[model samples]
Target: MAKLFPFLQIHDFLSDKLSKEILDYAEARQADFSPSTTSSGGGMAMVTNQRISMTLKDLAEFGPAIRENILAIAPGIIEQLKISPFEIGEIELQLAAHGDGALFVTHIDTGVHEKSEKPRIISLVYYMHTQPKKFSGGHLRMHTLPIGEDDVQPVDITPDHNSLIAFPSFAPHEVLPVVAPNVAFKDWRFAVNCWIHRA
Candidate 1:
């Protein structure tokens, strides 16, 4: 866990073989990824220039291993972060791809779908991009509370392949712009975003 920010970081979160299969599955379903949307004050979801990326939700049926594994470790993750425990409700799992120049500016994760009966409690991001890093940027930057008139300090977390990071859904964060420079979809920054909801 981070000293100041509440988060859990685990390297090699998935076996290499399983990771490869998951990656292949996401690529095979490339046609399903649509522009990711942002939530407005009125809870409407709309695609805007502020967020440049693609997303495919309801991926659990096809990615059961990934979903089960995440559930297995969620309690430990929450315990480590010192978050109050609550009955876990439906988990929203999705595949997200960040192509060249893609980014989601500073934002919190709790209200993406405000109409849902269960609210988001924790946010997990698992990076599964190619090795040797085909792209630049696309790092996860967590923002600290402003310090006495100073701006919010930023803690940049590199999107290491096969690594998973977890934090509270209300934490302010952002996906830095990615530069994939003439590369194919495989070179894009790929991630599995899991949101644990409170029942």
Candidate 2:
């Protein structure tokens, strides 16, 4: 293990061929995600303008490229957790847009549902924004605290277009607010969030 809490930036992790195929499939399979607006209207509020989401099974028609990436990334993430023989139960794509300061605030993505088999051991997020660089803000921030230390350190990750980020699910993290809006801001932020489990 390189570090107990580290953020990885794997650029161009998805091949062009696969990325193109997945994009096409995502286009056809994409569905508008309901507003997950938070009570607060600043750093972490989910926009009400536009959001999209798709389940792994729904995206299966897109071909093996998507599933292949999921399969490959999940196990590798587990290896980092020092856990072996684990499985991924469910995967989801979270697409958001800048609708009046919409952004995800600081919070841990632990299992939301009661008694979820997944338990969110690890979380894998893939950036699908065509122009990830042009967009302002929306950075994924990771926070870490030593076992007994009260002070927490933060790391910022803004992987280039088509990059992927994997880390422990228990880690406290949040998506920083998008400071400015762009022409592409009308559509979803375009990122896949997957939850992992023990095999």
Candidate 3:
């Protein structure tokens, strides 16, 4: 099915205190982060040096403010999905970061269980960085139309920190790797991944 990609720049999505709190938590626990590669049999080197900061079931553990923002915004996204409330499920947050040479291969997000009432109806991504130019090459691309056929090409979403990006989770999307010469100040490409699922 054809999908529409929409991005919302919610000013101050996270309060300053909350942002600092999360950043500190992530930095302290950054080393605990391990390489996450695709099922395509690629190693840490396959994509690049990076880490998955958190998992789906651990959203509440992040903090109060972060969780509050999520709670406030997630429902709207769910509403846009046109899916039943009971069909949606808990959201997930992952702190994605890249070092000097990091990359994420192109792939599609898997929906919820096949027999569920909601299933996976939508996908969400929040850009935590303020200055996206700090790191180059990590362009967010979405293919609304099937490749090899004439279409809108693809929606290009640069990591403009504090930008909230949401779209159909099942749509084909990818990260074009951080090919920039130098990594930005924080040197971390932080993002939050949220989804609407079948209840």
In candidate 3 the C-alpha lDDT for residue 128 amounts to: 65
Q: Give me the candidate number with maximum lDDT.
A: 1
TM-score of 3: 0.71
lDDT (C-alpha) at residue 181 in model 1: 85
Question: Least lDDT summed over 10 consecutive residues: which range in candidate 1?
Answer: 145-154
Native-referenced Cα lDDT, model 1: 0.84
lDDT assessment of candidate 3: 0.58
Candidate 3: 10-residue stretch with minimal lDDT: 48-57
Off by over 4 Å in 1: 1-4, 58-62, 112-116, 147-152
Task: For each candidate, give its TM-score against the true structure.
Answer: 0.90, 0.69, 0.71
Q: Which candidate do you rate higher for lDDT, 1 or 3?
A: 1
User: Which residue ranges in model 2 land beyond 4 Å of their true spot?
Assistant: 1-4, 24-31, 37-60, 84-88, 91-100, 112-116, 149-152, 185-188
After TM-score superposition, the amount by which residue 45's alpha carbon in candidate 1 deviates from its true location, in angstroms, is 1.0
Clashing pairs in 3: 87-199, 129-161
lDDT of each: 0.84, 0.57, 0.58
| Per-residue C-alpha lDDT of model 2 across residues 19-116, encoded as one tens digit per residue | 65665555555454344544222245454433222233344544345556767766665676565455566554443333325566666666532345
